[model samples]
Target: MDNLKFENILGWKVPEGSLPCWVISESERLFSIKEKKPFYDYSPCCYFKITQRLDNNFIEGHLGHSEYKGKRFHDDISTSYEYFSNYQKREPVYFSFDRVSLYRLIEIIPNKPLSFILKRVDSPKAIKPNRAFMIMPFKIENLDNFYQSYIKNYLKTEFNIDIYRADDFNDNDIIIETIYNQIEQSEFIIVETSHPNKNVFFEFGYAVAKDKEIITIQNTEIEKNLFFDRAHIRAIFYSFDNIDPFQKQLEHY
Candidate 1:
């Protein structure tokens, strides 16, 4: 075990009696936006034990949750991890987990693994699995109708896959939390970048960091204005008069 590189353990089953692991984060714990006040209440630590090796890039595990009094609150919770190496980031790779909400594990004990798992926990209430997440500027003019007519209807009717956007959530829902949750549940992401929107870019970055399948779309008018760095990326350029081709292009993904 001492000589094992983190990458070598990718497909190795975590045997019983292996050391317990804790996920530590350098970043501050995020709170719900609906509170209107920041609450620095929770610890940045999460405990878990790897149970089974899913593949070269993922692992199945049980998450540990303890109460304030040091009593174990939850154990053997089913979860899966997405390896950090998949994203090809220069920064310290972190494990992204979807449990009560989206969270990351920056470090682990025993052996510091190069790859971290993106975990998805099963919710008590079954959520309809989302096919794609639409990341676009919500304030764009007549965009809702366009989404309703072309994007949403097209995906549903042609592929039988549901798509969600930030606007679909209720007003009471916390904005960032809801966005992360939806992205976690989605199999792929579709980003509209016709307009240079900070929020859209942020979402796109998040999706990329998570190594999600990304499909970018842009309006023909502003296609020249796309970020120079991202120009090489293939994007579907569409117009109001002709969106069928774009819809058909999405079907292959």
Candidate 2:
């Protein structure tokens, strides 16, 4: 088993032998088997050993860490092989591994059924943009301050991107035309669908029709009130007390 040659699996090299093996590395952290790439970002300060490879397309492993937060902690890491296999069958699987404070994507051989890639799925690049046009119920009291202080400021400080609302424009053009023009000029759209506002829905539909990047944010209290037609769409839920997580989510795009 020691003499067996290994191949790249995401950021790790896996041996060809069938027996369970422990991969020990001093500097190497994250590896991609398909791309044969290595990423050092948020590399776990630990070692991993493949424990079992099940016939049901699942692989189990143990993560043994020497030190974490000035203490030792280890746990079992189990994942299904079918997840990566099915994903690779269609397109390359690019994903990240969350390490508490930081994360990174390590691609793996999509054809290898036993391979595991973990983390949040990467967002599509088509909707990523440097500027976002925000559509919300601006008439609502205190909503303007929330946008300016929480949403707009956060985007500017963290992502250095400009976010504009309808009030940002000073042109004397018709309201609908002005909005459409703003949508045309912006790279992406951020829709606040927390409330049942028809204007926001119309703007969202227009943005979708234009094939623009779209991100939806809503207050958690309004989840049950989400329109039936838009219920299936994913949205970032937030509350006044917990807006940081949503801001962090937006930074990814």
Best by TM-score: 1
The residue ranges of model 2 lying beyond 4 angstroms of the native Cα positions read 1-129, 171-173
Model 1 lDDT, full chain set: 0.54
What would you estimate as the lDDT of candidate 2?
0.53
Clashes per candidate, residues 3 or more apart or on different chains = 5, 9
lDDT of 1 by residue, 84-118 (tens): 23223433323232223433433233222222344
- lDDT by residue (106-155, candidate 2, tens digit) is 33333223233323322222222577899999767666777888989987
Report the alpha-carbon TM-score of model 2 versus the true structure: 0.46
* TM-score on alpha carbons, each prediction: 0.50, 0.46
The 10-residue segment of model 1 with minimum total lDDT is: 73-82
